[model samples]
Target: MKLPLSRRARSAPLPGIVGAARLDIRTKNLLKRLRPGDIAIINHLDLDRVSAEALVEAGVVAVVNAAPSISGRYPNLGPSILVEAGIPLVDQVGMEVFARVAEGDTVRLDGGVLYRGEEPIAAGVVQTAESVARATQEARAGLSTQLEAFAANTMEYLRRDRNLWLDGVGFPDLATDLEGRHVLIVVRGYQYREDLQALRPYIREYRPVLIGVDGGADALLEARYRPDIILGDMDSVSDMALRSGAELIVHTDREGRAPGAERLERLGLRAQVVVAAGTSEDVAMLLADAKGAQLIVAVGVPQSLEEFLDRRRSGMASTFLTRLRVGAKLVDAKGVSRLYHPPRPQVWPSVLLVVAGLVAFCAAVAATPGGSGLLESVSAVWNDLLDWIRDVVT
Candidate 1:
């Protein structure tokens, strides 16, 4: 069972087969060269669509997830990938069980008994193997179609928005009148984690101006980076981020009054209300460029066409204009995490907010009837929102 059969005879010992070697060592080796169409043993059910697509394309027939049985943490992209690819997938197998079958072990299947080296670990839901093959062809076709549409949208955005590329514009031009020597832009969402991780190392070396656009403020705070400024409507940003050391810029419409700007003033966080036409991210970039920022690092800025489609943005024209406004000072945070090593945050402000929330909840519950009801709803909603925030940050 070591691998493909040796020339001598049927008497050679395989690497992870019975009597050949210990289980852990064998399993590790098996993992090193794992290919598609093999039984997959996993640790969790949750997987993103990207990873799932990769596994399916690789042709892995099944996966053994070791995660909690019912977390529903994410879609088991792997299972769906297997199903669509016409491969078979099963879940929840501990590592101890999977080690029993090695690269060349013999195993039983529905239609026939087959060598482990040749057959996948599980079977698809469809009764016939021929049906599985057909499904795989269809799934691949569908994936291609989806990807094509994704590509078309992305190109359309780039075409509409000219700022992603600048001929030679650089630092000095992308700043406001007040002028920040350093500037950081935060765009909140799943991409924020990737962006922050990329920019974390750079923050220490170059302390730029910090500006959070709504949820981006939460992102900045999560990374332990103190924001010097925040831009956007007040929605999605935490009160703590607003109150934290940054100045606020409330994005408004052409009418010259923003409800969000009014709220910032009430909190004693003075703000400039800018009436703009695009998203908060676009405005933040535009304002930084206008403000004369020497260097601007934008985190979680969307680039792909599929991403724009998902966001349902009208086009890339606005962002393009903003980019041209900022010029060459802008650097994408999407790739930053790969090369940066950021410092650990000394502040536990986000964690403390949880404690403060609980205390507030207790006080509210102990107060009037109306207060208790209000606290209950707020607590649940706040927790759900916090969970979403946690997802974006980590």
Candidate 2:
């Protein structure tokens, strides 16, 4: 169940519960015991929009997210969905705060006293969900007001700058259309070799267009598979991969040039440099999605905020927007790999085969008793030599 945006300043009543709910369940399931006007304590205020349906129906008043779910990166599903469902959401509370105040803690949100639990502990409220909801609303409203200008500027950035979005977009949405064409996308680092091996069958079967994103080219080459198109900032990719016989799409920045682009030109290879302000992976995904590729498979790509943090990138908002725009046509290779249950040779079959080989060897030994005796003599002689050597060495 999902929830709608709910506000603390509601004319009517609140949900049944009035405390933190770190547990994520259907609003109906949650509302079975939880009443309207309850405060929800979640790990992070990011819930699937579909999941929010229940909360809105139940009329939850406030919510608190433990981690930084949306520091303005991807859209905050929890707070946004909750507030849209008439609920408020808070962010960045200490981990101990939830434990300090259990299901029935008396907490203050939106200037209202909510008795979360009768015997719950005390959790000092830093920022209330009510305040977060108001802030989120204002920020969204401000963005909406500037949407026209932002979109216009984004388009201008695309045109003047070699946006990653346009790289390899000549055949936008033409994956299946490129039927019988072998299109290879490259990804370097670990698991990509396995990825190529996994995709080899598909590559051989479908033979669609191939585009490698940076080091992805190196991975392809390692697997003895040549790439037809390579796209990325070219930082992680090898010089050999950059020089590989493929149509290179150098991902540039807003200033219209980057070292990668220059390197491609220096190699006498004129790349379709895309000057976009986003991650190379995002640009590659958007390009493939727009190119109408029958399928887009991402390998070893950062999928979460933690992963993004590992890379220390601050362009998640741009990347998230790109993903939102083209998420439908994309397929993450990792997710597909999770579902792979390749048929393993049955233990019985392997055992039978081993037994049969052993039996055949024994039969051969029996059939050639003289030869078997020679083999035994040779083994004895070798053992004797080893024994003599061991004594002498000692």
Off by over 4 Å in 1: 1-180, 255-259, 265-268, 337-394
* TM agreement with the true structure for every prediction: 0.42, 0.42
Q: Model 2: runs farther than 4 Å from truth?
A: 1-184, 338-394
| Model 1 residue 170 distance off true place after TM-score fit, in angstroms | 21
Scanning candidate 2 in windows of ten residues, the lowest lDDT window is 171-180
**Candidate number achieving the greatest lDDT relative to the actual structure:** 2
Score each candidate by Cα lDDT. 0.55, 0.57
For candidate 2, the lDDT comes to 0.57
The superposed Cα distance between candidate 1 and the true structure at residue 215, in angstroms, equals 1.4
Q: Please report the TM-score between candidate 1 and the true structure.
A: 0.42
Top TM-score model: 1
lDDT of 2 at 355: 99
